[model samples]
Target: MKAAVIGLGVEGKKALNSLLKYGWEVYATDLNVNINLDNLPISLSSVDISPQNDKISFVKDNLSIDLGFNNQEKIDSCDAVVLSPSIWGSKIAEHYKNSGKLLCDVKTKHRDIFTIGVTGTNGKTTTVSMIKEILENAGKNVLVGGNAGGGFEGYYDLILEADKQDYDFLLVEVCDMTVGFCNHCFDFDLIALTNMGNDHMDVHGSMEGYKNSLKEFFADKIIFINNNQEYKEEFRELSRLAIEYSKTDYDLDLFGKFNKLNAGLSEAITNFISENTFEIDEKIIKNTLKNFKPVEGRLEVLKLNDCEIYIGKSDNSDAIKAILEEVDFAAVFIGTPRHNENHRLDILNEVVNANPEAIILFPGLEDTLDQAKFRLHALDYQGRIEIANNLDEIIGFVAEFSHNPSILIGGNGQENIIKIQDRLKEICDSFNHKENRLLFED
Candidate 1:
């Protein structure tokens, strides 16, 4: 009956509340020593406000939010430990397991609802969002979550909210790391693989390891996979019913061949779900595809007078290649961090091959710009390459000098990319109103 929630980040907070609702004695810990409660999400604020609330009193009285420095004692005393997916495979988790304690991850339980899990190196968020949209358009009560921003932040929150609501389908974005930790714990009716490519090598340690992690997720489930993926055959063998999807050539609102693949995967999953459950009209699928907007930070476009800006969160080489193949950019502002050394080389090579007019590297990357610069030089790259100290410099350069029809701003981290998107939107708004014509002209 007693549970200890580790890592009081977004997922941890949701786990704490869910455990409380399930009538478990919940204790919580956060490794962030400086988390401000006032800045916490409204979800947490709603739960913390009631002093007369039994859950609030139980947590406050028994748990200490002490940066997880003294959490081992609390964890040892608990019957079960619920871990945030971020802490999966960590030393702390291994130590707890060695001590003979029951450990569960965020993906545990929620078997009552019909779940559709989408996993791959790319297109997970978009594909899952599309499935949610298509199902909802068909009048199915659906809750979409896992890895997308705004409202549906994490799977833990989604599962908790779905439990209270009347949702016929729960669309989840399942990451490889999550699958690696708790593959056996997931009870999904169906699953989808967007596409697999070289990504997250730092975590998985090798290409083989990353692929194996994904393979573990599809076992015994009816899986929908992209037919064009290199590892499709491998994935097909593992699933109970493996459905392969190819590019549909639909004039989708989203750009890129990969996105087309995403749409194809989405449609396949929707059709499978609909055929088994209810009749989803073909018009609903077509309309949803035609009108579905691109996921934020994934090839989102903004057009100016002489140039267009494409912002996305593509951190890996394959994702970057997909974007480059779709749009010819005069310049590229890359914010992806250098995690996997081999993948970094591949990304640099792709950037060189694309041969943009300029390449502006931003902060938030693990590898230094100097190193990337050296690699570019080695590749005989002729384009302009500079490392901006901040996002402002990159924006200023693009606003002033970029004359090509399109420019790209994205990679790896969402933090910097989101900031660029907001700032660019503000600037674009001013230009649209003719209030900042002088800025662009200069």
Candidate 2:
């Protein structure tokens, strides 16, 4: 038997292992033409297998590698083509589907362990982390990881590891990009959504398409979603088990109203899990909630001298609006990679409406500064606009010139936040630096 795996991302690597385990001659390919594995001809060993699987090695004899393009004819020759979650909606996946080839995603064999799936446009990582903390504090063994994707192992890796360990619960963070495939790949015992928003419209194609995907993915699954979610009414009729949750009064260490909603959802799930299975103390849940700090990339607060700066990932208008609701910022900086393809220019209107005193544009995937200036000009925004050379420039301006400025930094992930923090530290370390009390003291 022969099989091909397309898109050598996390899920694709998992597919390779499974196909090789089944004794199939596998042809692997990735779209990144610059993979540079000895100019494309490479062995299966070239891929990074998780240390957990170091003991279980694959037979290299049946593996053939190709990078850059997915040769339709070559893949069609295989009995099946397994796609990575990242490649789900691509032309290659569509081609395989219609080419009479058995097209599928990396599938997890049914396991008896109780599984919980967390998903939404945002708040997935925070909610997943909260759930893990609560579960662990309650003395339950848990294996947690999924589309959390911010320097965490992919869900495919976690699921495989879960099979080897005797875990009480398997927590998976499902992103919209992977939600459709997750429906077929994971047998989730329960699913929880923080909230829905206008996100990933480009990947899903349209708002209706995005909503439909969520509806279908949540159908036949026990789900907990925000009561105010747009699809709440429809989900009640579609989901096999649907429960609506609202904001809670739990004293969370995290910031923002959205975090409160996430806490509420996590609390509801933990309470239900306790009632049905292993009992968790109310005190433990409260303590866990109280001690659970905000995830690094979501509404993370920092200090530059007396100025308060808040940073988080804001890709869509809904997220930006949500942040603006909780943060009273005098200045806001926004950036996004491939801004045009990722979203429309209208998203900038939200920031304008928020009426920040000043707006700064930082370089991102493209000329976001110029693009944003054009949009702001079109919108006739009244705020002062400036271009920042880097995060260092923004930090210096806020620290030296501003009067305890409240700043909001948007449109970067956790990795970028770390880089920004490093740059801030370097600035503080310099002799020509503004002052002490730079960041992270409190």
Candidate 3:
């Protein structure tokens, strides 16, 4: 058997590795040919493509490797084509489909795997991570990946690696975009929805469309859903084993009522798995819940001098509202990559209504701080509004002006977030190491 793996982003690389491990002659392609393989996620780095030798080749930036086969010819010669979620609707995918080649996505290839797929607009990474942790505490050999770091780079990679390993269970973070592309391919043994909200409409087109994509993928699966989510009733007809979960009080290291609810969902899923698959001691599960730490970049708190800074990557109105509801902020610094502007404006309006001491907006690639400033002004907000030149300027301003300030840094740019996080941690560490102020003598 032969396979063609398209798009060498995280997921595509995983597919390439999986195909090779399964002993299929593989060919790969990426629009970006100049990627340094060493800099990729840890999972991709371990993929051994060396064994396939001359049978395996890559097309980079429209140029074929010296392997003596053109890109299109290699793709056409493959028995099956595996597409990453990013390239689901691309012209290349369309071409392969038209050629009558068997086209499948990362999820579909592992349809028979005993999988727990989690999907929602928010809290997906946290919830999935919790599930993985709880199951591991129960002494189950588990593989957790998809959209976040735990096992591999992407779902494709995770599934591929899981196939080779002796994992007792698989936990996957399923994105709505992935559902939109490979809904037909999903065969989850158990599924979960954290909470559905208005998000990714730019890709899904409309609110109804986004909901339907989830509805279709989750239909006929053993499902768990949030009882408090909007449109909860709509999901009732989608599955026969649909179970609804509500908020539960648990002594947890994480903050926010939403996180408490996430813990509840994780507990419920763990219980369900224990009941259906294997025996899990309730004591161990409880201990794990009590000790579970907050997922990184989701309301991560850093104390500097007299200020308390909360940094997260929350880019939607609902998530922002949840953060503002939980913390009494003196100031907020927000930066987001270009996304649905009108939706962001609505979220910003809610931020204004929260009425912090100051609002700092930073420019993303597509949207400017000036645009956000205008929106806040139009909302009749009378509080201080400032435009941040950079993440450092925002951090410096917050440290200088406000006492006990709550600095919120969020956006869609993961690279920028990592940089900001590193700088923030460095500043906090430096402050911690400084000598205490002398009360009376110097």
Name the top lDDT candidate.
Answer: 2
Per-residue accuracy of model 2 over 1-442 as CA lDDT, tens digit each: 7887777765676556656655668888776644434322235555533222212212246776655455667777887667788766677666765665533333243356788999888788888889999998888888877673544566555654654568888888898878866776577889998877777777778767888888888888889988888868788788898888888797777778888898899999998888888789998888899888877666776666556677777767888888887767888877645655546444578889988888877765455577778888988999898887676776665664345557887764455656665565465457224443444353
> Pairs clashing in candidate 2?
none
The reply for model 2, stretches above 4 Å from the true place, is 1-4, 9-27, 31-64, 68-82, 89-110, 148-150, 339-346, 365-367, 422-442
Residue pairs of candidate 3 with colliding backbone atoms: none
Q: Which runs in model 3 stand beyond 4 Å of their true positions?
A: 1-3, 7-71, 86-109, 148-152, 180-182, 339-342, 363-367, 433-442
| lDDT per residue (tens digit) for residues 252-297 in model 3 | 8776788887888888898897898887898887888888876666
**Model 1 clashing residue pairs (backbone):** 337-365
Q: What is the lDDT of residue 58 in candidate 3?
A: 35
**How are the candidates ranked when ordered by lDDT, highest leading?**
2, 1, 3
Give TM-scores for every candidate, taking all chains together and pairing residue i with residue i: 0.81, 0.79, 0.80
Ranking 1 against 2 by TM-score, winner: 1
Question: Distance (Å) between predicted and true CA of 397, model 1?
Answer: 1.0
Q: State candidate 2's TM-score.
A: 0.79
The alpha-carbon lDDT assigned to residue 19 of candidate 1 equals 65
Estimate the TM-score for candidate 3. 0.80
